[model samples]
Target chain A: MSHGLASRAGRISAQIGIVVAIFLFWEVAVQTGMANARVLPPPSLVLPRAVAMLGDPVVLYNLWITSAQVLLAFVLVAPIGIAIGLLLGESDYFGRAFKPFFFFLASVPKSVFLPVFILAFGIGFTQKVAFGMFQAIFVLVISAIAAAESVSSDFLKTARAYGASRRQLYLDIYLPAMLPVIVEGLRLGMIFNITGVLFAEMYVSRAGLGHLVSTWGMSFQMVNLFAGILLAAALSIAVNEALRWYENKVGAWRG
Target chain B: MSMRTAGGNDDRSGWILLLKNPLVLRLACLGMILAFWEIAPRMGWVSPVMLAPLSATVISGVTDFGVFARNLGVTFGSLALALLIALGGGGAVGLLLGSVRPLRTTLLPIMSSIYAVPLVVVYPVFTAWAGIGVESKVLFGGLYGFFPMLLATAAGVRTVDGGYMVAARSMGATRFQMIRHIMLPAALPSIMSGVRIGSAMTAIGVVVAEMMAATAGIGFLITQNRTMFNTAEVYFGVFLVVVLAGTIDWAVSVIERRAGSSYPRKVRTL
Candidate 1:
């Protein structure tokens, strides 16, 4: 057990060591004029700005806007997507007939539709949210269908033989069977949601973290740009890790 | 006695069978969507300006074929170059990491963490570095495609059966020969899936880069037309992109299937 813990610790240190080495290399490169500081600011400059930006109201507001759009899109799409998925999954004919279309849509790069959303909904909060919904719905639906369909037909048949009511079948069997996968779908959906919102905001937005990063980049404010990019990355990782944690919690019963 | 039905009954049942065909069902489903696309705008259910009719979009596509074809050539060129870079670099790195357990253990977590970061936010920085040209787009798209290929290839390599390696070694097979004949075939499905995803991402990155800031390409065409309120042309550009992406995805899957059948195991690859 101690040996296992030591190896894990060694692995983590190696990961951190690599990251630190990269940053240190960057810092030294910039100082020595080997790398252009204006285009690629060192972490020493970026890290402080990143920390300070957390207390900056403007930065905070942009973060909030992006987060709100993602949340709104997720909230609106999840129930409807799950319901459609369940129906399609439960019906073999409909599932086969419709799944191809769903897969095709999902495979398409949804960012290309940003302009269409802007045209239809205007370049405002609604447009960003709509784009997020567009990106997220397909992922959620596809995953939810997979989750629902994963429930064995034999289990359902056995339940029916035991005179289980429809309510009992759903409550006792389907929900428990599908919950972990559903949570996993939600996690993926949230990631897509973040990407969609960020893409839309970056493409053309008056306010948002994406816009802040873009603006900083355009003006050659490398420090601020680096900081903003780092901040966005941190937020995304936080959300992803949180969802992953929840996914593990829900899926623990499987083991 | 034969159990064959009468001619009239056979004809009716044949027709029913045709309707029941999976291909027919899929086509019918898509046909319905196309029908709605054509009818909705024409029937005033949706404004033509917001959603162009299918006919109008087709007409627009035909009329603007020169513009689209020229831009498409540019986008396709960049996509090809970006995909080449991504697959080459990612495959090499993945191979190294996968074969070396210590390296894989250290790096896989960091790779996933990086993947979680929506890499689009860094595009502007890429533009600043490479300029708003095909170079920037290629770089951005290459970066986008890199991760999936890396992760997938690594996973594929790691999952390779040890028995094959042991047998090859006992037979005095060289390291290079074993990897070439055994590992490559076994890992082909995963690598091909990586190609599939990588191509999609590369296309998206190139298009998004064009859309964000570019003078040419399919995405730029859509954005330019949208600003001018030429809704049909915008729809046409979008259709072209969807078609391009779909074709690439379909082609990769075909390649994957054909190559994967050589090894003949149901590897549930990503």
Candidate 2:
């Protein structure tokens, strides 16, 4: 047990070591004039700026709004995706009929629809939510369909032989079998939704992290822009890790 | 036996059986959608301008094909450059990491952290540095595509079955030979999937990079039209991107399927 713990510590130390080395190199390069500070600000400058921005209520509010948009979109699309996927998986006709359309929708560069969305819903949260939903739904549906199809035929047959009804077979055999795949789909959906929200904000928003990034970028406030970017990156990582943890917890049930 | 054969023929007539075949049903569904779209505008249920009919969109696409082609060429060029860099750099790093357990453990999280960062935010930095040109797009695409390929390659290498290495060693194979014959073939499927994903990432990178800064490419077209309120042209630009992305995705899928099928089935379960 101690040996295992030591190895874990050693692994973490190595990771930290790498990060330190990178920072040290950056600092040295900037200080020694080997690298231009204008192009790449040292961590010292960037980190302070990030901390200062954290105190701003507007930035926090924008972050909250963006997060809300992503979550709402996920909630809106996930159920429909699961339903459509199950329907398609259960019936080849349904799958065949809708699959191509889904593929086309998925293939479309969603950023292009910003104009239409703006036209229909105006430059409001509704439009952003719609874009996010559109971005996430296709991936979820596709993944769910694939997952549903992956359900073992033998398992379904056994359930049937035990006098299971259609509903019972679906509930007992299909749902459990497809849970992992559904979670995976959800992961992809979340990622796409996050990306969509950022893209939408960049394209048409009065305020958001993305807006802040662009605003600072145009002004050439390199330090503040880098700070905003770092914060956004941190938030993305946090959300992803949270989702990963949730997936693992849910996945444990399959055992 | 004759009665059983007759029963089988009757069973095959079920609607459920027909619906179970995706290819036929999917095509029919697409036809139905197109028919609906074509009819809806004519029936005045939807405005022609709001949702341009397929014919109009196609006509506009062809008429503007020269501009689209030039934009597509730039986008594809950047995508190709990105892929080359990603495959070359990612494969080399992944191989090194895979062979060195400590490095893999140390770098994997950092790599994922980089991947988790919304790349759009960083695009401005690249644009600011590289200016509004193809160089920025290539860099963006390379950055976006690299991590997936690296992770996939590393995972592929690590998962090379021990038995294969043992067999190769027993035959007096050198370390390089073992890697080439045993590890590479074992890792091919995963790496191919990575390449497929990387292709999409590269396309996305090009689009985002262009959006951030570019005078050409579909992204530039969309941005230009959007600002000008030329919704139709905006749609046209988007449609072109969609078509290009779809074509590339289809190509990748074909390659993956072919490569996957040709590889020994024994490697699959691994």
Candidate 3:
């Protein structure tokens, strides 16, 4: 086998070894009575509970609702962020005008606005979506604006000198330059989106993973609660990995 | 030359003119928002029950500020304790792990996964294990804050130029001396950034803990208000949280700027 293939194999083996070791240790801890299953439920118990939760329609419905809110919030944030960023990037006057206001809004803990949102939109998807959007939009806008700002002035000048139309300038110069940053903003936006949706669900939701966890907690179902948490972590990691793959693909094209 | 100088002066004046020109326009925008919010209810544009006018919310929030301040104190105290523990413990562990490549490779992933774990889920466990009080909140906050601190410090240590250490060794510097003089200084920026992020995380952890189960803190106030459907008080609690977060963020930025200035000229220039 080639050296690279051998190393890849070795790495996979190492990862498997680590996973096995962790489980072994955990199982041993439970069996030996070193760790209380009440507080820290062994993976044996937690895994089955998680699988059972997957079978539940209510759990699935909640997950769907939360995911839908996240997607909707991202849709709301991405376009506005790009538009504001483009405008801010294109004009020194606009940048100076809005920078401080953006900073102020960004620094405000978005959780504070949850009540305001619920008040305005009521305790439903609207409130959750608004909370998620508020959490994400500021970061996206700032990152996009920064990206836009970094587009070389020389490139713009050259485009203008070549009699390029404004539309062509934007399409050719700005979009290509800002795409990576916009992707990065989306990645961060997803984090905020997930957190916001979950928080909202926790605050006043009839269903969702947050609701599941809260319900399990209130009922002292430690195993189920642990299972829900593990699922959430797994979901977040999966989303993050997918984004990283996309980012790498985009970055390669940029390179 | 004199004409060109006069034109430069004109440019400066024009910039100042532009700066001063936006104040009224900005204030007008804010006024417009307030007016709309106020009149919309009166004009049936929105439900009065849903949103109290700005005046009423502000008055109620002010009246409730004493209780809010006490809760704020508890939250901030918990945050401070968490910060101290995370920085000290994480910094030490980071330094150790960073110096040993094998340890770093083996442990970094574990640290990161712990960091990424939806800490909110673990809140109940913490409450159960540590009891429902400030101690649980502190531990939860510290755990949330710890990962970033360790990651940042390790990153900082790794990024320190090998040349600096080599040169220091050639000059007969001890390991302790190198760490104190070289590593610490070089790592300050990353460490500060970690602390800043940690500060935010700590606040979130504390608030989440309090919301889950706690007797006192701004988060408890929010929870209490929410339960009572006292929307105004809920907003008031939120406003206090925003203020507290903003203050911590602003303070970190100021300190970072000052620290940045004190870095070596080459590093600062970079």
Which prediction has the highest TM-score against the true structure? 1
Taking the tens digit of each residue's C-alpha lDDT, what string does model 3 give over B1-270?
Answer: 122222223546764454454443455567888888667766778776566566666787889878888998999898889877777777888888776666666666566655545566667667767887899999988887788888888888888888888889999999999998888888888888887877777777788778767899988888887777676687667777877887888898999889878867465311
Q: Tell me the tens digit of each residue's lDDT in model 1 across A160-198.
A: 999999999998788878988888888888888898899
Which whole-number lDDT from 0 to 100 does residue B105 have in model 3? 60
Cα-based TM-score, every candidate: 0.90, 0.85, 0.86
All candidates in order of DockQ, best leading: 1, 2, 3
Query: What are the interface RMSDs of all the models?
Result: 1.9, 2.7, 2.7
After superposing candidate 3, which stretches have Cα over 4 Å from the reference? Answer: A1-16, A154-172, A253-255, B1-20, B34-45, B97-99, B103-118, B170-172, B254-265, B268-270
Residue A173 displacement (Å), model 3: 3.9
Residue range A1-255, candidate 3, lDDT tens digits: 254877657655776688789978997899789998787789888888888978889888888988898889888878987788777766765665676778678766676566667767878888888889888888888887888877778888999999999899989887777777878778877877887888778767777788778777777888888888878888877786678678767666466
Q: In model 3 chain A, which range of ten residues has the least summed lDDT?
A: A1-10
Indicate the worst ten consecutive residues by lDDT in candidate 2 chain B: B1-10
CA-based DockQ, model 2: 0.49
Q: Relative to the true structure, how large is the alpha-carbon lDDT of every model?
A: 0.86, 0.78, 0.77
Candidate 2 Cα misplacement greater than 4 A, ranges: A1-6, A100-116, A150-176, A253-255, B1-28, B36-49, B166-175, B253-270
> Which residue pairs show backbone clashes in model 2?
A92-B19, A93-B19, A96-B26
Q: Spell out the clash pairs found in candidate 1.
A: none
Q: Write the per-residue lDDT of candidate 2 for residues B197-255, one digit (tens) a residue.
A: 77777787788777656888878877776677654566677777778777888898998
Over A1-255, each residue of candidate 2 has an lDDT whose tens digit, in order, gives 255988989888998899889879988999999988998888899988899887889888888888888889889999998888778777765665677677667766665566667655667788888988888888898888888788899988888888999999878787777887888788878887888888778766887788888777777788888888989888888877787777777667666
Clashes of each: 0, 3, 0
